[model samples]
Target chain A: MATTSRVARPRLSSTGDALRPDSNGSTRERLTALAFIAPALLGFAVFYFWPTLRGVYFSFTEYDVFNAPVFVGLDNYRALFADATFGNAMLVTVEYVAINIISQTVLALLIAVLLHRVTRSVFVRSIVVMPYLVANVVVALLFYWMLDAQIGITNQFLGWLGIEPVAFFGDQNLAIPTIALVNTWRHVGYTALLLFAGMVMIPHDVYEAGRVDGASEWKMFWRITLPLLRPVLALVLVITVVGSFQAFDTVAVTTAGGPGDASRVIQYYIFDLAFQRLQFGYASAVSVVLFVILAAVALVQLKLMRAGESDVA
Target chain B: MATTAAAPLDTEALLDRSAGGGGRPRRGPGRILAWVALVLIMAATLFPFLWMIRTAFSNGAALSTQPASLLPVEPTLGAFRRVLGLASTEEAQAQGGSGAAIDFGRYLLNSVLVSVLITAGQVFFGALAAYAFARLRWPGRDTVFFLFLTALMVPPIFTQLPNFLLMRDLGLLNTYAAIVLPFFFMTPFAIFFLRQFFLGIPHEVEEAARLDGAGPLRRFFGVILPMASGPITTLAILQYVQAWSEYFWPLLVASEENVRVLTVGLGIFRAQTPQGTPDWSGMMAGTLLAALPVLLLFAVFSRKIVNSIGFSGVK
Candidate 1:
């Protein structure tokens, strides 16, 4: 299974020497390194790089699966702007992302802080994080069963409280928010665990210092904890935003983007267009738009993080 | 102001005493509130799973009743038996009254095979590439690594349409390869994670191996791999859970019965059960079975998994 030649090599002092053009061992070292990385690089090229480029190309063409892709210039983009469902899908996606990020972040921060303060027991921490390991499909299914208007435990509890049993998935207005709630329910544990991990890295001395300064617990949280936790908090925010924008599995299983396209986010819209409607070119165009939005968001996050670091310095 | 001034000194004395005693700090009202909040959150978080267990054990008739019991009145394994294909249709109908036995065993096996292969493939290839990035020197290394990182920012939906078309043209649609190929090799996150770990290894160990006349491959295999086992194991667990939980791609490609993974199979199960009245008991059982493996993995490797999350965040 080994690909490299078994030639004995010199023990170079620094890695920089191995890259020198004048050295006799440089070519062989390069060969060995190339052999080591070839499999993954080859797979990446075939699966990710090539497909991404072709996808960009396809966005500009009018291709169904049946016919060869005919170059249509900007037709797909022009049509995407005019499509009412596409616009609605974008709006719905933004709403979904906003609710999901806000709820998940706030709940996760609360749970993480609580867990960090109360316990160091692995058992308790695992209990909080366990739901995250469960598949999104399973979470969506369980919630679907619980939110079933007629016999769902949620509705039953509401009835006991003298409230009307509202249809979660049946009503267009409640559908996206309901899905967002379920998504948050499924992921908040993970976000909390990640944030908790970050919290653990904050030295105990820092808290003691806050105590020394006569800071209230609330003051310490706002002034010290949140400020010190910026890096991980940014990570959590970016992950939540990216994930919520691409929300698919829960919507697929629960609403199927239903109640009259009320829950149809852009990812599901792309899936429906490509797989169900066979509109490959239009879907590609939408995919490019999605790609641009995500990339821009990531770049902005990186820039903001860098600026934050420099300010701290 | 006097109390606030004394509080820090008191806390310092407490800490010094605890340091000598090697015991935990005293619990206060804050601790009590934290516990109360934790208990409430835990109840909310775990209630769904508890409900799933209740439904899985209850018969279909019990579920249809008004004000469903929090605990099953008459517990039975009939739903589990039917979902696993171990129960006869006649027996299921006799017990639950309108249950159908799905070929869930096949789907379970498919899920296991796909997840294992993808996990193994990703960890192995990711390690190889990470080793190169960490220790080896080659021209254009930084550029190539930058390109790989760029892949992380591209939303997966961007590639789904083209990947589907490519799979169709290659006649790989509906095959397990279709589900496994794109993801099985490596991912940018895995490479970045493993590279950080590999870079932490001391250079002196590899130098000693060189003194013993060991080739680069032998040194890597005999030394670096063993030293990095902790991170490797963490990556394996994380990757396995991720692969098993995958849904969207599998649904897109593995539409055939023979190749269908559990997630897609469950989706189809939900869709196929008559509108407005689903097989709740059986569906609950299916959901339980699907979630059990990752849950078991977490139960065993909870500490390592938690540490891995912390480790990933540090950089």
Candidate 2:
């Protein structure tokens, strides 16, 4: 209990107290803080700040490999809008984000609620968090074999139910779903782990009050649990949305944008242009579009989430 | 209004009757169904991993017989041997021929070296920057910090071409620098994470050290840093796992065999196979090797990693 209190204590008061004039150590203390922070600040500017400036500038130039960038004056942005592949990539990205947002959050919440109620043993807690430890590549590889239609265990199990072997990765309809399912499988555990932490922090007396009122489990969950969980839920949703917009690796590895680029997500498309086709300017323009999309989505989501919190209170 | 007040007396009498009825040996079917549903979901969740372990041990001959065995009727160490390079050509050919010759040991060593160096660099630079951002009074610190945060949402692909150009110009291509340099330095995520942890730490501790006549560097090195060891270690573990698992950036730059990390190497190896029918056994072997560093890190710092995910999101 004391340790929990210590962990929960605010640090501002302590710091304010230390800054009192009679201490005679104020100037030296500030100097020490500055010294500690200098190395990081220097690296941040050179690596992050400078490159960010360069990225914005390069978006307007036509630069292929083996040549200096020449100012193109919005030609790259024009080409991006006119490109068919960009449209397809945009469609694919929407489907991916939509499916992932719904599935990852809902399943994460369900699993979190389930895990929160595990009263039998503490061992369940550790086992529940294990999948998040596995790398994305490993998860991808695992799903690749599992969905291989020929020797895949998923197909083999379906055969037992008298269903024909399905081309999960090959089919246009199945490809996005396959990737979404695999992503959800890998991330659900991690998301649930976070949600469970939120659940754990809720004071026990609130639940007891619901019990005293003879509230049904569903009613209590809807009225009490979810309202209290809005902050963490909102946080996860925003991050997931931004992350889904950047989805590249799993699709790249699983299908390589195959079956005539059926799973050609925007990020992968941008990558092919920059690296494979040497269209650096065009890729940067698409990247800027993606950045705008993500920024807008995040901003709207934050506003709605804040509104939800106010409404609940 | 008088009837509304009198209704409570009638509800009290009914509640007393219902309480007696509720204890009459009846159980809620909803609760029972919820438990059953939970068990089924758990099984569904865990079955894939169980099947993976089973598949890793089975071979081609037994892999496709009438009524294929669920428990590996003729289990063999052949797959593991071929993966680890102990099998002869006959065993290799039986699995999927020359395609499975991934040289897992070499790839394993490469991954370890890259991940370790990247993790060390990320933590060091992240700490320095985080310290500055958290405690230092610098010109335009908040603006610079926000700029770095914007990098987090930029979708790494945006910077790929530019970074590639920069790296090529510097002649860092086809080297460990290609894989490590871009990422081995400070990451915004790490800096943000560490800054939040640092902000949570009390200033009194460092002030107390200063009162002892210790200089700024001494207070930071001796006081704030020691206090931050928990979160610093957590960030290190997260960065290590991410660096070990990174595929795309490394895929873009590390084209040469000499500098190829495991993830890219595996992809290229898979692509070069006959008609793109990737050598399943070898890919699995390569994947297992690639996953070792992350798995080991998790084993060492399971609690810290799990806790960090929550703390990381809090900021």
Cα lDDT of model 1 by residue, B1-315, tens digit: 000000001112222333421222247787687788999999998899999999889886567674468896468998888877788878776555345547778998999999999998988998888888777777777778778766776788777778888898899999989999998776776776677667657788787887899877887799999998888888889788888998988998897889989999889888866475777888888999999988988888887776566525221
TM-scores for every candidate against the unseen true structure:
0.91, 0.87
Q: What number of clashing residue pairs does each candidate have, in the order they appear?
A: 0, 3
For candidate 2, the per-residue lDDT at A282 reads 77
Q: Where is model 1 more than 4 Å wrong at Cα?
A: A1-25, B1-26, B90-101, B311-315
Instruction: Please report the TM-score between candidate 1 and the true structure.
Output: 0.91
* TM-score of chain A considered alone, across all candidate predictions: 0.91, 0.90
Model 1, first chain, TM-score of: 0.91
Residues A238-290, candidate 2: write the lDDT tens digits: 77777777878787777888668788998889888887888887778888888
Runs in model 2 deviating more than 4 A are A1-35, A119-122, B1-32, B66-68, B72-74, B84-90, B137-139, B274-277, B311-315
Tell me the tens digit of each residue's lDDT in model 2 across B1-315: 000000001111222333322312124786576567667766766666665555666664456552245564356666667655677888787765463445556666777788899889878877776766666554555566656655665556656667777788888887887788777666767776666666657777766776798876676677778888877777777677778778887887776766767777667655656364455655665566666567676767665555445524331
- Candidate 1 collision pairs: none
